[model samples]
Target: MSTTPLPLSALAAPIERGTAAYRRANFALFLAGCSTFSLLYCVQPLLPEFARDFGLAPAVSSLALSLTTAALALAIFIAGALSQQVSRRRLMFASMALAAACNLLAAIAPDWTSLLLARTIEGAMLGGVPAVAMAYLAEEMDPRHLSGAMGLYVAGTAFGGMMGRVGMGVLVEIGSWRSAMAAIGAFGLIAAIGFAALLPPSRRFAPRRGFVARHHLDAWRAHLAHPGLLRLFAIGFVLTSVFVALFNYVGFRLAGAPYDLGPAGISLIFLAYVFGMFSSPFGGRLADRFGGRAPLIGGIAIMTAGAVVTLAAWLPLIVLGICLITIGFFVAHSVASAWVGRLARADKGHASSLYLLFYYFGSSVTGVIGGWAWQHGGWSGEVALTASLALAGIVLAIRIEDPRQPDRSDA
Candidate 1:
């Protein structure tokens, strides 16, 4: 990848701040973002079905989702670095196209191992989008509208997640899991084409001179050295891990426990994500008004309260708890993601990739640990584990000084 800086002025006009073409570009990008994540996570609800069909354990089935994220995290750094040489629009277009194909292949896999292999590759391909999208936005969108645009993009992600899980569950009831997966892949293919068509050619992206080993290393070091960035990264890990863990096993608890429910019934739980879709943008606005610190701390506090609510045996209380958790997670995620942009002086793509790497690592690791908690301690134990993680997030939030402080660099 070349290091030559693209003409910053050409791409500097925020898309959201520009003419009608820019607004169309932003909307198209939002759709692309939603489709990418929706396809990636559509397999989640089908995990239990995979376990039963393949005669595997819960942990083994989870690898279908976990392996994809694991591969995605590892691939993000490489993809981000590579995009320095490639056009952002072209890279993202190719990524969604390839990921869609991978999903189709996974849908027809004859066995569990083959399915996992396809999912891993899908994850790797999907890495291109998140690793580059933010930097693209920062380069192109007007500075005044950048945060709001990013917030909308984050909300799109939340919507995609809900649609993926809930749509899969509903579709699986109508057809087979394979069909559900295929449908999502088809949707992704359409979205990819739309994204390519709508995204204007980059005026600001200049090819990097070439890949330098030191550049990558320096970028990582600089990102890690910032106290605010480091704290945000840690929070990203814990926040996502705790969130994934809670959702991974909540269905199991509901399906088997005092509130016995079927797959369809379990699917309804994802409706809580609607709250997340709203919360993300709302959180971003709050961050703008009150600074990131208040939303970060307040979100974690809500999450802790939600985790405790889940401890109750009552079904209604459980639903309310899940809603609270959903709201908290989105608020926290929106704040932290935007904070990364504000914190990094350069190599914004690399900084975003590092944040997501930690984000998904938490998903892969604590997601599994959460399963262990489920098996041994049951729902109560899982709640305890989630609460502990949220508390850690709260502590991290408390330690994050204001980004406007003298020591912090204003990007």
Candidate 2:
């Protein structure tokens, strides 16, 4: 932890304005991001199997997935704040490695309760990566390349998320659910080692002298003072809650009514996430060209429309709706996340963690509530819940006026 402050030019110089090393580093971090998210979400497709094997209801079985995300949301703030004391590279590497081990433990668990405990631990360990990765890029990457690098990292996350959902589904079809989980965990372990090998030593990170409650409070105060930051935080909560709720209950709906899809078929629905990979990068560039506000608002609108389309019983329309939803989610997420880096004056790590804490908190809370909707109101109920959340997001986006013009800091 270097106590001395270095010039901004020196800290941000490692990734030159436009250089190959910068590009390579960005790509490496993208892969690292993918691996981290894939490991975190791999259990999504296995929810039904857990219910059958454990003799639980839809909401109870969902606890397996929801608990991990809940733990992750809580731990992210701790991890980000702690990074001020520890080395970023060492913390990220350890987080991935330990999370992988926890997944392995989950694969071998004898009962549902044991598996849930393992996943909770894994989620806590996994929090270190996302909470700190954005800050690392902000500190090291050139300002011009920041959005691109962030977009690439997000692309990796989209891909990893798709792979985790689709891969688990495919693997479970051929083998037991435990085998699928173990395989995904092994892949994560390998990716973790690769990430450790490829990520260059941090050249820009400087450790704070010590953690103080005042510093944390000041960071929060600074963030809350910024209108854009508050809007982004609200959007994070609403967008993620809506997205998670849709995905969480889609399988249940598809498995029950007209579709009667099996676990493998249900897993295939995650294929829609492939659209997110492209949309994320495209959204970033669009934001770079046309300001972040328009695309951010437009993306949410598109997602809202998609949620409406999903109400149809026609499978094709539902698939198209999912694709639109996926595209909208990644675009909004990429812009909003990159925006957080721009808005925070200091302690970017803490800001990023706060953003993700709201993001995952939405997933954990709304995801379980979605099950109740699915049970009672059927697909219509699910649609109503998600659409309402998306509508709230749109209203929030509308409220976020352009901050380009000078305004009082304390509004």
Candidate 3:
């Protein structure tokens, strides 16, 4: 069932953004991105519904997602290692298809525990895509144009996240959360088929055909010891913690108070990801021209300001603040993600996996902790925690110097 890879020299040219090869690569990966994220986060808007139907606390309901992310974080480590023995394209397609099926199972589960179990397994199945995507791009694309491709891939994730949140919000108006989950699972199935059909075979990769733990361990150790890579990993943890925590509790905040937004109205808030779609590429371009440090710091600053602004009472102002935070998160993430490939001298798959491990770990930990803050201190408490995380990210960004660039600080 395996096709022999062509010589590396023949396929090593990085796909430029406008060429036909680039078009095919981006379209397939974009769909893959959309499917992966939509399935993963589709449960977010349904947290309140779970609380009402299952009589779970906010912190308990948060487990539905936290379990998925926590499992995904650990699974990514294993998946990244497994990918060395499996074809990248096959691994991603299988991941998407399996995760979609898991979503459908969750939709039909009769009890709360069953649904959580489904989500946890879904998270583990979904790990193959993100763990290997950046590595695929790092190996396949022209190194000079890598930022643009990564930006586009990230943009797809934003769109997928928006669809998951907004679509669930809108779909629930017609049916229950179960129906929403079923519908999104169907969409994921379709995207998975398209991804398998459109993606070209890997020319640069040769499957290792078996497990090799020592190699992965060495790479992980080397990356952890490198100061620049270490800082980037820390930044991933901090920024994602802030982003997920804000969105996790914001649903509860908007649903309860003077705003009293319904699910659909709360769903509209995720439309802020539209800003994220644009900011991802824009951040990547900035990184290409200037450096990762400036955009990274600027994004952290914007995220912090947005958190502070959300403390305001006005709904319009709060929405604006969310949009700013969304934009900042995507911008910072785009830079940091692409930087991983550039920074890793070798074992790019292991490097990319480590970055996402921290990223999702942040989501799982802060996401639940923020719910606790909500239970104890309300919106103000959530804002305080997010703001602090953002500030820490900024400080880390300031202190770390990019090895690829000179010591000068100009952005």
- Give the per-residue lDDT of model 2 (tens digit) for 73-124: 8888888788876778788888888999999999999988899999999989
Model 1: what TM-score? Answer: 0.90
On a 0 to 100 scale, what is the lDDT of residue 334 in model 3? 84
TM-scores of all predicted structures:
0.90, 0.90, 0.90
In the range 186-205, model 1's lDDT, one tens digit per residue, is 99999899989888876666
Give the poorly placed runs of model 1, Cα more than 4 Å off.
6-11, 16-22, 52-58, 203-205, 404-411
Best by TM-score: 1
Q: Ranking under lDDT, best-scoring first?
A: 3, 1, 2
- The residue-level lDDT of candidate 3 at 293 comes to 89
Candidate 3: tens digits of C-alpha lDDT, residues 314-377? 9999998999999999999988888888888677788889999999878778977998998998
TM-score of predicted model 2? 0.90
Kindly give the stretch of ten consecutive residues in candidate 1 with the minimal lDDT sum: 402-411
